[model samples]
Target: MIEFATHRNKDPRLSFRVLDMTVKNEENLKRVFTDTELNPGFDKVFSFACLMWTSDHEQCLENIFKLLRSGGQTLVWFMGYNDLSIVYKEILEMKKWMAYLKDEPILKYAYHDSMDVKSDCYNLMKKIGFQDIISDCERKHFKDYVDIYDFKVHECMDPYVNKLPQHLQREYLDDVITVIDRHIKNDGLTFDLIILLASKP
Candidate 1:
């Protein structure tokens, strides 16, 4: 994602740095910044699909706070729970596959639970001393069946599909693709995407 962004913006003033380390390590985080004070040295921090992997969401927010200059902002985007009316049929189809792959650990890791902190994002930012906190939930409705089918397969199934037996991987992927294709044609899927924008005080 960063690579794509940097490639599109070639101006030297627009610098992009990719850190290969986790935010849990404060020491490693400090190495990325020149300043050692409470406020490190960035005007803005953007987190996309990263918080879900972090073990400590609040700590991660704190670390980001430490890196931002006073009044700097952080923008976060993450997935939230699906709208039952729109996703119920799709969920039923997914459950069938999940039951068949119940023994797979990756399946459990990928689908059994959500790592997203969608419900707590606003409160977490407030607790971390962010001001002017604003959060919005947008329901995305896909007009094209292929678009949503592709999204579900890639975002929700790919991780688990990679862990299937070599011979079964293709079969599993094909099965999911078929299921999504069928279900989506009947009723287009809708899901909520949450965005949080907050400023460090």
Candidate 2:
């Protein structure tokens, strides 16, 4: 939650500090960074770190290197774009997809852009100056992961079949209604989520 001040530039309390998140919460990001009394060097920053989709990995690593005592550990987590289409296709089968689509328009646009950015998580991390890239597929071997569904149908199917033609959109969507019916019963599955863990070593 970011509180906006109309005259933030003149605020005396405004300052910056680097922080690491050990837990999943990020509502306090602006607060942690803007505290005047904080210093990444003096504070025992998070030993376990997490990187989110919005975090700049380079800045995170740089802060860890500069502020953390040597041998201090930071864990960064980020989302990967590889096979994002297929993964989203699977997620559409889940109940959460509808609620998400109602609020997110850029997600579909980003999905379109991802087609050409073939650098999977590992490759992109390496390009950004990370080392010790490790791609882990172990989660696929376990059942704890959420089941996936063919969500791409929602993204591309409309343009694929409609293309400004209203009749065509309805025709395609109606046919999908049948497939969706069976899917709701757990009969549909799609996509692979590859988890890659990279390090600074």
Candidate 3:
């Protein structure tokens, strides 16, 4: 990544660092790039099934552009919000509750914004000067992708649940579990996963 960045800047003196953590603090970001040409920092970058949870997805995409070497590629796989096909009534109700929780200020950051830039990831990449953009959507039954869904919910949803009011936390957890169980039993859950590939120009 550093090599790619330096090459783009045409400066051998440039350097880069990859922090395996969320880039949320501008001060920390500034500190990390001191005395270096950090633009166009990578040859290839990838995010797997993770972009949907970000609050400022536009900013994130912009940063990714800044960090990519010219002609560098980016690959991202994320969930599509409107593509979930749920037939079970109980699961539908649970989905409503989940939506309500997502609106809460305390949990908003962890929630996925279905209509954010992520919804049109390919277009966003093109708008950001990316070329050769390719996007594909894959739909699958929840039972077939249960492992992935389980991991995502645990990683993204559990944290929010943990932060809820103590009195409500257990109840929420129970309800969510019940919904999952019912959906699995009835084969009522389905998901749409979108994959995007683009190259910075």
Worst 10 residues of 2 by lDDT: 137-146
TM-score of each: 0.60, 0.33, 0.59
Residue 187 shift from truth in candidate 1, angstroms:
1.8
Model 3 pairs whose backbones collide: 41-67
In terms of lDDT, the poorest run of 10 residues in model 3 is: 82-91
lDDT of 2 by residue, 1-201 (tens): 023343455466453344453323443444565333323332233322134222344455454434343333334333333223344354345453444343332223111334322254445557645455564321112221222225443433232333325544554454445444544424333323334444443
**Stretches of model 3 off by over 4 angstroms after superposition:** 1-28, 31-40, 82-119, 144-159, 165-171
Candidate 1 lDDT score relative to the true structure: 0.61
TM-score of 1: 0.60
Best by lDDT: 1
lDDT of 2 at 55: 34
Local accuracy by lDDT, each model: 0.61, 0.39, 0.58
Local accuracy of candidate 3 as per-residue lDDT tens digits, 1-201: 477776787756445566423565555455665435355367877877556556565566666666677888888776664223332234334554556455443323212244543346666677767788886766556655345555555434343465466677666666656655655545645556777888888
Question: On residues 21-63, what C-alpha lDDT tens digit does candidate 1 reach at each position?
Answer: 3456777665765454435567888988555333456777787
Off by over 4 Å in 1: 1-9, 20-22, 36-40, 49-56, 83-119, 148-176, 182-185
